[model samples]
Target: MEDILRQAVGVLRSMWRFRWWGLALTWVVGAAAAVVIYTMPDRYESTARVYVDTQSVLRPLMSGLAVQPNLDQQIAILSRTLITRPNVEKLINMADLNLEVTSGPQREQLVGELMSGLRIGGTGRDNLFTLAYRDGDPKRAQRVVQALMSLFVESGLVSKRQDTDTARRFIEEQIRNYEEKLTAAENRLKDFRLRNMALLDAGGRDYVGQLAAVSAQLEQARLELREAINSRDATQRQLQGEDPVLLPQMPNAAGVSIPEIDGRIDAMRKTLDALLQRYTESHPDVIGTRRVIEDLEAQKLKEIEMRREAGPGQFGSLNANPVYQQLKLVLSETEARIASLQARVGSHEARLAELRASAELLPKIDAELAQLNRDYDVHKRNYETLVQRRESANISVEMGATSGIAEFRVIDPPSLPLKPAAPNRALLMLAASVAAIGAGAALTFLISQLRPSFADGRSLREVTGLPVLGTVSLLGDPRREASERRGRYAFAGGVAGYAGAVAVVTAALKMLQG
Candidate 1:
């Protein structure tokens, strides 16, 4: 520590050797620096802090809850906009700043200086932003900050209003279109019901009763036809035996009883042909008529055979045969009656079946119409509900609006600075003093280096190779150096000239600054 102190003393002593020149220069340079600092225009800075609303910063939450704007995106947008040319120019105009550049280089330099003074920063870990601007006038800086705030707020409101209006109009159009589609669907269902009356199930009233009645009539007609056909077939079998009964009595008159048996057979064959012409083979009456015709044929053959066996004598008696005559008469009359009854019954059955089919079709049509009506009613009700809601929406649109997307609020106010933030007079003066002292030291060092004499007295002896002589002191006060002292006067004059020149230059700089 002592050695360090001793080194510090040695440096100070060397520095003090030029004290006279150093002190004079220090005052002159310091005064010049002061003048320059005071003459320069004072720069004023204004700053404002704003807290960005988290609502604008958060992302839109479309589903679960209400959405908030993304804060990070808003901050980024603000950052870029803060440096935009339009914003800067507007600030300049609004603040009434008078700035000029005499040349291209000057303009460029001024731009750099302006950019350096303008600052935008954010509060740590918060959604707060700070904006600052510096100008020659304090009021201009304050006004510039205020102008930016107003512009941002107005711009945001304008953008939000436009977007909300667009969305509202689009939703209205969609609602109207849905309403039209719903109405058309309802109308279609209504028309379909009107066309299919059976859809209502109204005409199916006697469906079961009518079906049963038609079935009963069919059964009864079938039973009657079967009985007639069976009776006819039984009679035919009995009459078709090998021989027919003969009539002997009225015989005296009919010993001629077989008299016209062949003629009678011819009459019966003609009656059978007439019956066949009136009815189909499968008809109940036709089956009975056919069976009767077969019986007549068989009985006529037997009589003819009997007549041939009894010879021509009993020919007339054949018709008088009791069984043969009785058979022929009954067969012809019954066949004729059966044919008429069958024709009448068949006609009634065909007409009844047609009526029954018509009844069945009516019920089906009614059922279909009923279903269509039900569907139409449902659609119409839904359409009416939607239409009412749409009307309400329209009225609401005209009355008031509920769009609330964007809003702004002030966060922090501008502050007035307590101290001047420009020029830095004290620091400038100190710097000038240091430079002046350094210049004095440098001038002394340069003079010492240029001199012809050696700094070490022993070096001169060694170069000349001579015996040492009495030592002479090169440094001393002029009055104290008795031997000639001629070099001392010259050295003093040179130092004086240098100091005088420094004083003149320092004074000129001061005058210029003032």
Candidate 2:
């Protein structure tokens, strides 16, 4: 600790020995630094605050019907894009900030400088944002800030309107496309129906039902025809018999003995029953069968009355015999029934043939119809969705036009600054004083190192590594010593005077600036 203290004391003494040179260097450097600081151009800043209103009175009423703009997101986008080249150019033109820039590179450099000087920020946890610009001229700074504010607000509104219009136009285009598709589908379906109306009408019965009905009717008709032919043959044979002229003992009117007529009535009744199983009573075949049965029964009753009134064997011819006549009538009726049944069978066969022909085209028609229906359904759904969106977009546009739902209000207007915000003179001067002192100390140390001298015996021993044996003292004339002392005082006075002059000049400059 003692050694360190001694070293510090030695340095202070060496500095004091060259105090005049230190003072001169200090004053010169400090004055030069002060001048350079004062000559720097002053920069002024202007700022404006804006508040965004995100809520509106009509918002609740139009909640699901209209789109709501995101104010914070819009503000973030504006902050990033506000200083783009095009916007900067617009600002430059509006503010007349020519900056004497004519070439492309020069203009680009100017834009960059302007962007660097401009600042946009959002206040913490609020809907308020600030726009600020820095420039050498206070008025220009204020003008730039005002221009930024106007551009930001106008751009936001214009962007929102453009988005709304775009949405509406897109929906309209989709609706037109879907409308054309739906119309085309409908036309195709109509044409298909018109081309195959017959098949479509029969489609209601289904293939299985039609086939079963036609088959059942064809089998029944064949059975009835066969029975009728047999009955006709049997009646003719009975009429050819040798005893055909003789009548059987006549029974009561209620108990007629006409086997052929009775058999015909029974067959008709069986047919009616079979038909009833498959068809309603109102069906044409059922009605026809019932009528035939009633007629046969009436004929049998008439024959019974004829047999009761005729005497036994009075009519000798087979045609006059009541039983024979009855048999003949039955035979003719059976033959007619056979003919009618043959015609029905033929008609049924023809209908089956026609159904088979139509069935061949069903698969192809179904495929095409299914595709058309699918397309129509898809287009219909898309058209409906687009229509709803279009209505919503229209509502949003109307709301934007009428209401200030996402509006920017200039809460704090830009103010023209009277004083420069940069080039702090007091701070600059203090820094200059510190730098000057450092430089003065460095110069003093350099001078002392160049003119090396031992301050004490230990220093001499350290440099030479030799022993110091004796000390010598020089005696001088009194008058010469006194003259040297006076010269030293004069040198001190000169250095003080120079330092005082520099201080006075710096003070004068500061006063003039004020």
For each candidate, the alpha-carbon lDDT, in order, equals 0.56, 0.75
Off by over 4 Å in 2: 1-31, 96-110, 188-368, 428-514
Whole-structure CA lDDT of model 1 = 0.56
State, as a TM-score between 0 and 1, how close model 1 is to the true structure: 0.38
Candidate 1's residue-wise lDDT over 329-412, tens digit each?
Answer: 555454544554465467548746665657757566556545655665665666665555555444433332343333455677
Error of 1 at 337 (Å): 48
Writing each residue's lDDT as its tens digit, candidate 2 over 180-277 gives 98898889878987886755534444455666777887898888888878988998888786244444453344444666676677767777787789
Top-TM-score structure, candidate number: 2
TM-score of each: 0.38, 0.54
lDDT for 465 in candidate 2 is 97
Which consecutive 10 residues in model 2 have the weakest lDDT in total? 312-321
